[model samples]
Target chain A: MDRSQLLKGLLDIIVLRVLETEDGYGYQILRRLRAAGFDELGDASVYGTLRRLYRAGYLSTYVQPSESGPHRKYYALTEAGRKYLHQMREAWEDVSAKMRALFDIAENGTAEKGRA
Target chain B: MTDTPQKNTDIADYRIAVERHLADLPASIREDLLNGLEEHLAEVSADLKPGVPLSHLLGSPEAYARELRETAEFPRENAGDRFRRSMWRMADPSFAWARGTADKFTGSAGVGEVGEFGRTLRPAWWVLRGFIAAAVVTHIFIFGNDSLREAVLSTGFFGLLFIVAIALAFVWLSLRLGVRAQEWSRRSRRLVAASGIALVAVGMLTFSWVADGFVYYREPVVGYSTAHDVVDEGVSDVYVYDENGELLTGVYLFDQHGNPLYLGDPWSCDDGRVNNPFEQEEQESAVPDPFAATTEPPLDEGRYGYRYPLCPVVEESTGADDPEQPASEPSEEPADADPSDEPTETPSRTPTPDPSAAD
Candidate 1:
């Protein structure tokens, strides 16, 4: 299966993890994610994801009021976001275990026996 | 941004393009997307050569919008969006611009001029708009007793209709003011500013100066505490105010010179909303103009006397402080005060059902 579909949903968690370290701005967050080795990540994707989280009360925001052609919008995690991250981590662990078992069984000749 | 017209137009063009695609999105999302896009564009532009366009760096505006749409995790599941969608259902049919209205502006020469003029008049339009918005906000949050609010808040089947109607009018005006001012000339901009100032002045005048400046000072009129006394004494009076600031009880209805009021009939629509007026009936004519011919002539005939061949015209010089006007205090006329000398004095002072209107 193409991992892109799987990665799409997990990107939100990855973004939250990045924010968990320190509050970052749009372009900064995108840079941090790229540095963390999600080399294929798109700029619009990261920014859009941040907006989605911020709007849903998963993140709190304030303007930097920077003197610029454009003002920087800063995003930080909320208490709800912290609670949410814990639940997502547990759910991820469960999914991770189930996938490992499936991979191991398929590698063992169980897949060939089932086909016969 | 302190950019040159060249740079500003570049960004403006980009913003407009992005907004065009975003017309169907929620306002909050569109705004966030724009802000993020703006900052990103600015940062990217900083690294570019002076003559390079943003499109050269970011690729097509259409592609950017599509990328944002696909990637952004919009909060589409919220109840707020549901409510907004419903409000749109009510507002859109009446106020939504036709698809080609914008294209028509650029396509036609005559329309372009009219559109430009409308944009020039925007500053004035905004003042009146601000007043309306403030009025609605105050009505909802500050005063439940306001009549405009009451009309909207009326219970039962009709109330929904009233609420919908008010909301429609509000949305229509806002949507109608879509003309952007970038293309307007400096002279046109100044005209807009001047008209805005003029409107504000006129608005201030209505607070107290209207009706020929009759409400020059606070009247020693009746208030809620004295409502019983007014009704018991049977004074069917009328009130005219500039701004509906206070239902001021102590208002004098005549000009400083105490000439009979040259004011119009009381506006009862916005009246009696917050405070219960002493009585809840239509105000009787304050001026008794016997030969005024029309059922309602303005109070300005300011008569110490009239020279009619048949009818006597009262031309009494009574400003607010006419000394013998202890006589003006009572609702009834001093039967001896010559009618010709004081035209319509008593009716103006006392709030009484006009005997003439009955006729």
Candidate 2:
């Protein structure tokens, strides 16, 4: 499966999380995502996620003119964005915990069958 | 940060292409989506390697726009909107084909070099478009029915300078607009495109008018000689007389350059009607008499074939006329004659040379 396809659903949460610590512009946010090992992330995916989040009132933007370059529209996580990120994190943990427990039970069942 | 003009143009062009793909979206939403795209693209370009293209780093503009659209969770078009869009697509089948061909060509190898070369020429096209736009605006609003040449001529040197200044202003305005057009709403963009088409139409009409003016100014007026010695005071007929007071016939006159001296309207002798001097066709040879008119001339070489006295008549009244008296009489009679009657009286008065001599 395409990694971008897998990352599609999580882009909003991932982008919100990236903006949590510090407000970042499009290219800078994309860079941070790359550093976090989502190397196959498409450029437009991050931008679209930011747009969606901003539209949903989860992110706020401000224009920060660069000293050496063009002005950048920086995206910061709003109060709503932070709360949403927290909920997403909890939901992700809940699903992963359940999957881990199911995998352990399956492994034990396979082992018992081997013993039989 | 240190982007060259070419780099900036490339980014601007890419951003516009992406925006074009998003034209179906709500204007507010599309504007919001593209608000800071230019700066973002510039940053993206800054991080690229020296020769790396933005499209190479990202994907095709269409794919990028699609990804953006999909990931943004924008509402899909209704069936009716989809149908209308498909109909539009069908209406411009050539546009689609050309776009596909361009995409394929750009995707192939060696396009980078070509693209880079083409990028260098973008500024020149922008400048030319600005000039044409300025010319159209001035021709319509400022110059007011004056052809471009006439406007320039009437305006004189400083006015021309002012016009150039306006064109330069337009160039600056166009360059700025071209860069920022990606941020405009679709409606505004369409309005601009429509105005652009209108401007081009006006420019072409003005250009043709200007071209015709140039042709008119350059064309020499027929029957009016530019030569230094040729008399331009409407000398309709040349009456040459010998020193012995007899009318000269079958005479041919030439200047020092060996070119036959063409004086007056050669067609004036027939039907008492002169041809329109501006008519492009060369005049027929001078007819000796309207009753005896023929296509073939009595003399073979010259255009005005008739000898000096086009209407020759045998002298009836004066058996022997003084040459000095006839010569002096004509000069005074022509000066006193009505200018309108000169051409008609010239042919008829050939035989009556002694009227003043008899007086």
- Tell me, by TM-score, which candidate is best: 2
Each prediction's Cα lDDT score? 0.55, 0.67
Per-residue CA lDDT of model 2 for B1-359, tens digit only, reads 57788788889888999999999977877887888678778888888766677899888999999988888765556778878877886778887777667656765755644456466666675677788988887767677755765767687997789788889999898777766765799888777667767777778987797787764443322223432123334554556444333343434443333334455444454554333223212333452233223222332333432344333322421213534336545544534532323233333232222333232
Q: Across residues A1-116, which tens digit of lDDT does each residue of candidate 2 receive?
A: 87778788788778988899999999999999999999978888888888888887889989988887777789899897898899899998898899999999999999999999
lDDT of 1: 0.55
What are the iRMS values of all candidates?
A: 3.3, 2.4
Error of 2 at A79 (Å): 0.7
Instruction: Evaluate model 2 with DockQ and give the value.
Output: 0.35
Model 1 ranges with Cα > 4 A deviation: A1-5, A65-70, A110-116, B1-9, B47-52, B73-359
Model 1 chain B poorest 10 in a row by lDDT:
B304-313
